[model samples]
Target: MTDLLWPGDARAGDLFTDASVVEAMVRVESAWLAAGGHPSELSTAFSVRDVAVAAEGGGNPVIPFLELLRSRNPEVAEHLHTGLTSQDVLDTALVLQLRDTAAFVARNLDRQVAALARLAERHRGTRMAARTLTQHAIPTTFGLKAANWLHGVLDARDALSAAADLPIQIGGAAGSLAAPTALAGSPAAALERVAATAGILGLPARPPWHTARAPFTRIGDAFVTCTDAWGKIANDVLLSSRPEVGELSEAPAEGRGGSSAMPNKHNPVLAVLIRRAALAAPPLGATMHAAAAGAIDERPDGSWHVEWATLRTLARRTAVAADQTAELLEGLRVDIERMAATLTAARPGIDAERRKMGDDGPYLGASDELIDAALARAQGKPC
Candidate 1:
């Protein structure tokens, strides 16, 4: 089936292209060759299509990729993947791809946080009915609502950044440096090669983590958290944009958000898609968690194979969701008059509460202070 659901226009769209993945794999291979003090020059004259058919024979792409490399570079072919295995090359390449992806997602997240901060500051005093259990319970400002989103996005961004800063994977056949030591003349020299590979890829230098899957699990969780934060905003948007509520609406764009059957419908398309991503991400993350749980022995049997597509799907969906969230916040429309009208309509409940307890000032206790604290945190000041 065609991927009609996710639209790709920016940096996030191109990071995981087949060609980019192949390039990353080739780069990893070259880094390994150079780290081993071998002739690293090899042919980059093959495409993913060239290796796709032959990949099934070995259950991974690296085997066929090595064949193509050998065919193209007869002189350096013998030393192409000297002490490396398929998992090493593929995992390191995946890290390289995620390095780029994390940068892209972080930029979009910064935009989203900035947009939300502005909204929170601008709407600090716009009174709206605060609902509990789908019913109006008290008065609150839209600023406070936006501040809640801002807090979530800020935490999500930090979590993603820390999780994406993962170490490069460089284990030989089995999470042991035996082959690398044999090739490099000493165990210390073998570790140096791993460090060199880390330097080349701009990832952290750490011991082999072929079977230690916590890093991948943490990264998956971070992606899910991103969708979790954005999904909450989308949920609120879906509810607030209702015709009956009419307190918020997505800003109109040309040739966008029109219903197929209804001519007068302006659908909440961005929020809908973000919510779709939110729903889709947790299961993918769970797959990684399950794989991690089942990862046994020197390497996993079938569990290791499950991570490739699962991580790619989760990362792609998250990148798209981050962009959608930023766009949603950038063009979000808040109806101040409607918020005031809704608050006015909820006055009967407010009056009933006031009769029970003595009349208080608007029942918006500490909302302004909470908004101030959120803004302070956004500005790097102590809240």
Candidate 2:
């Protein structure tokens, strides 16, 4: 399913792949072993595809995965899991994938922000008609609009970056790792040692967080916010690029946005896809919140399972939008002459003082300060 909707960075795509799921299984098992727990040849019985097929029946990949692992090598079966439950493995794997995804998000966002900043700076005085409710209301600059877009992107980027420090989930079925430590050793000490091994794999196992669910929720919100930023940019791009408006356009490229029915037509394909992603995002985010509400009693019935696809889709879609936005900005074509033509007669009631701020003046209240703050945010620096 992701293969069709997915057309973005390779690394980002890899995070959600079947191979990645298997790789995570290996990491989790190895981490358990590294902590002085003895495990077996894991793949003795069922193959990778067999585990996946088994997951269809159990609603979780871990149950079948463990069964296959132990069945293949019974002698080492007892030493394998070391008291972890299916939820523990699944949840921790999610955190691991998200952790890797954060780096990809950071890279793409940085590129996008930088491109927008440069575009905004160049068009600081480029004027256009500011619209309210889809009607021309006042004069504004293309630079200010770009800056506004930059500000939103910056906010989303910060949210995602902060959310990136996701805590790994490592609780057993009932939300405790006690089953493994109930025998002799100190639970805290053993858990800490195992967590250290997890840390080595780049997934920081910072305490247990299976019930919290904040990490997933926060990331979902960030994904929604990020896509929304692109949506605004895409919406404006669509409007401004229209033949009637002609203020901006998707930079002309060979075989890009070509209409199948009309050879003469060139569509704003990137913006279209970005807007589509934004439209899809809010609903997905809502689902995550709804799922959070249902995460009751120690484990959720279907709520937790709901997020398995929702969060992945949300994050993946946002990543694709980010990459497309960066590419769009790189080749974006601005028609300064056309933009200025729209300002022959400004709206009657705009304040004279506000209008004096230059072409970008009236619509950009404190935009200079805002853009600076946005730049600081993009760089992950103190403002």
Candidate 3:
């Protein structure tokens, strides 16, 4: 899973990767063994590449992975994958991977929200021109704009939190706990095993969700929501950083925003990349929803298979976008002088119109109050 096109893959840390997915799947298998009162430590003899190559025979990595594990760890051969199907192993592993990814995304979004809060507080009265339909409409403050962005990101954070609080998938063959219950001697014991396994992985325990695709859909939608908020900020930055507008600009780094052919260009590359992710998110979300809708049987033929890579890609893009947004906000260079100048240039006509409508000054009604309210809301913890 090396891709030059995806900004997420180019970053330093491996948030989501082929190797990480294998590691998560291994964790799920280990947890299952531990819950069954067996030694949980499994062998690490197989490489990710080996499992992937072997997965061609089966539809997923779990089958081949278990084969390799069973061959290497003969002690746990009977217990490994005793009550779980491929869906159980893969879905639970995905949840674990999403759990870690959610934490990382939440941290970056927190950084973005904190930075926006600072901007809102600092520039509470820094007036600027408000645009409507891409035209100068009225007077507004930079604080209000930043506050607006903050509100959107906060909403996205909450959505991601709700989606991240997902339960572990432990349904046996055909979405039933039959095998586990028969093995445990009772359904209650089987559920206890599930709860115990979930506890080990720091996830909630729930009944079989093999057919219910809402959790995966929700994760996809959350990723879209996050990127939507980030895209709003990037769009604003892109428009305002135009040479003609000169209202905002990314703080310069040594190798950032340079052009290959043009010598005098300092393009807004960060926003461009964030916007790119934003544009791609909605389609991925739609794909998840489509998969959910087309999920027909206890285990879908192709729809369930469709989810693994789509969700992984969505997570990667969303996580990378969060990091980009945090960096964008951290080094955001707000040109208060340019904003004031733009406001001064555009306010007179609107002021005259307002005066004729019995207003004495620019009607910046509730701008300050709304910013305060947004900042107050931002005080709440990130999900």
Candidate with the greatest lDDT versus the true structure = 3
Clashes (N, CA, C under 3 Å) per candidate: 0, 2, 0
Query: lDDT tens string, model 3, 92-118?
Result: 989988888888899998999999999
Candidate 3 lands at a TM-score of: 0.97
Task: Report, for every candidate in turn, its global Cα lDDT versus the true structure.
Answer: 0.86, 0.76, 0.88
Worst 10 residues of 3 by lDDT: 7-16
Scored against the true structure, residue 134 in model 2 reaches a CA lDDT of: 84
Clashing pairs in 2: 44-72, 45-72
- Model 3's lDDT to the true fold? 0.88
What are the per-residue Cα lDDT tens digits for candidate 1 across 189-217? 99999999888778898988788888889
TM-score of each: 0.96, 0.88, 0.97
- Residue pairs in steric clash, candidate 3? none
